[model samples]
Target: MSGHSKWHNIQKTKGAADAKRSAAFTKIAKEIIVAVKQGGSGDPANNSRLATVIAKAKAANMPNDNIKRTIDKALGAGNTDNYESVTYEGYGPCGVAVIVEALTDNRQRTAPEIRHYFDKFGKGMGAQGCVSWSFDRKGVIVISNEDEELDEDTVMMDALDSGAEDFSADGPVFEITTDPDAFNDVVAALEKKGYTFESAELEMVPQNYVTMTGEDDVKNMEKLLDMLDDNEDVQNVWHNWQQD
Candidate 1:
């Protein structure tokens, strides 16, 4: 129901700049591997989960060749990656709720590294369900309208008709939210009408937001996020920190 925060903005700007393209694509490829194995198909047409992940890859501007290669590799013989989905719930400075979602082959190595990050901020990590209670898992789709060429009313109507739960416009960006189960269906519905996306993926939407007023608190929070982002195993990080 609002603009995605500073962490999101940082990722967008960096993604657009290709500053972390290789690393980002590597993480996404892991998602592809899991999606293919779990969904039991390499073809996105028949696999809703794979379709959603492919939409995410497209939004990230991952190359078509890379995507195809990853899918092929996933379906190939002797592919031996077994990634377990793990979620870490924690608090940052000023009681900011943070959740880190990861896919790791080895829990032992990934667990200690994640714990180290939280411990850096005074044992910030907590039990799995601790902070997730305050968030809703939602499918969010974003569209860029920087030139104001996309009409708000038309877009809103289209999104609503396509089964979006909510629509919000901030400056030149439009966000459409949907139920996680209906995410791929909504995306496909919109795409059929020639709508392109800036980002389309499931996310942990925080129910409330809090600001970090102290300088040290903000610095620690930023560092914590950076450390997580640097890890190849970590996929998504969600937080309630209100950032500009």
Candidate 2:
């Protein structure tokens, strides 16, 4: 696995123990709202974006009732909150490229708050596309090996047959990659075969990674990520920091 992929796995492990469950739920809820509005439907059957978000929520162990409630609320007449997708690019400590994806009702407030973290914990915020050009958007599906029931070769073949571009094992997880447009289709194919994911989402994959070893740089990078993760508007954060 690549360094960023490893770092992603580490963060997933840490997130479970992190005292940000409520914040996580809030972020997922906002995602549901955005997916519904953007896809022009609240039903996952017709909304691929919403289905992807629902899958992500389930991977996070979000309760079924909570997920249903979120969808119902989004479809309800009383829910009128409008969110727009926004992305910010920047360099974090030790010059690690960072990308943040957010859904916000107020970019005026969200932009400044994000810039504050970049200024405090990173070098500073960069202009749009400054760092984004160095990344490619890809569909990523993560499957856990905790159950010990998965056969590596079988899984690999299944993923390949289902439209995955690449597959690799990272310790206890299998990371599957696909073209962004084929993400939902591959995910659905896997689901039909009774496979579940640890996490699945479209993510920014860095073309090149930056490795940070200095103590201060690593600390600052962690702090910056935590701050971004805690922000409800912030849905996903990607970086090229190769942890050592």
Q: TM-scores for all candidates?
A: 0.93, 0.93
- Candidate 2 TM-score versus the reference: 0.93
Best prediction by lDDT: 1
Model 2, span 75-108: residue lDDT tens: 8889888999999999898788999999988999
Candidate 1, residues 113-189: lDDT per residue as tens digits?
A: 98889879634789989999999999989888988889999999999999999888866778898999989989999
| Steric clash pairs (candidate 2) | none
- Could you tally the backbone clashes for each prediction? 0, 0
- Which window of ten consecutive residues has the lowest lDDT sum in model 1? 5-14
| Global fold similarity of model 1 (TM-score) | 0.93
For all candidates in order, the CA lDDT equals: 0.85, 0.84
Off by over 4 Å in 1: 1-18
Which residue pairs clash in candidate 1? none
